[model samples]
Target: MGEFNLPVKQGYGENQKTSCIKCVLWGKVAEAYAPNIKKGDLLVVSGEFYVEEWVSDSGKRLQPTIIVNQIQLAKKSGDKQGQAAPTQPKATEPPVDFDNDLNIPF
Candidate 1:
């Protein structure tokens, strides 16, 4: 599995709040798309949402997570509707080593 942080914005003006959601992608989807995702790139994702709860030295913690089933690059603000986002060139080597376990501190 591969995971990334997605920033979400809600409400407007004075009431606006921004949150960072943890998204997890598994198997083929992670291998195919994870390498191409970059910071500042807008993405559309569909998945199951839930809160993962755990306890740490500090205290109990809750993390909102998404199990991404489908994901796609979203069109830029200047692009016309129905137009696809530009694709990045395929890399000769994988950008991340997914075979090893990630050292994520929970």
Candidate 2:
């Protein structure tokens, strides 16, 4: 599995500003629906909408940036579409090539 870099956000008391790394995993597909992603460790990204928001200080002014969602991993393969949440392996297993490189003389 590839490495996923997630942002960390903290809330400032009494501040109405949205100081959080809000992101959506999935909302269009039926199997996947994540309206608001919060600060948690349950983010299992598999073709999931990966986004991060941060403030950049430019010339003594705070600039807010909104990045589009990124799919870290593509949709998993299965009997049906949108089946990446499950942990079951593929139905058909490919043959192993452990000894394929061995050259035996007759």
Give a tens-digit lDDT track for model 1, residues 25-66. 776657777887889888877676889999999999999998
Per-residue lDDT tens digits for candidate 2, residues 8-49, read 445677753444333322222211222223333334333323
TM-score of every candidate: 0.71, 0.20
- Give candidate 2 misplaced runs (Cα > 4 Å): 1-19, 25-31, 35-41, 45-106
Q: Which parts of model 1 have CA positions greater than 4 angstroms off?
A: 79-106
Residue 14's C-alpha lDDT in candidate 1?
Answer: 100
C-alpha RMSD values across all candidates: 6.5, 15.5
Q: Rate the local accuracy (lDDT) of all candidates.
A: 0.74, 0.32
Q: Highest lDDT among the candidates is held by which one?
A: 1
CA lDDT, candidate 2, residue 39: 38
Error of 1 at 14 (Å): 0.9
Give the worst 10-residue stretch by lDDT in candidate 2: 24-33
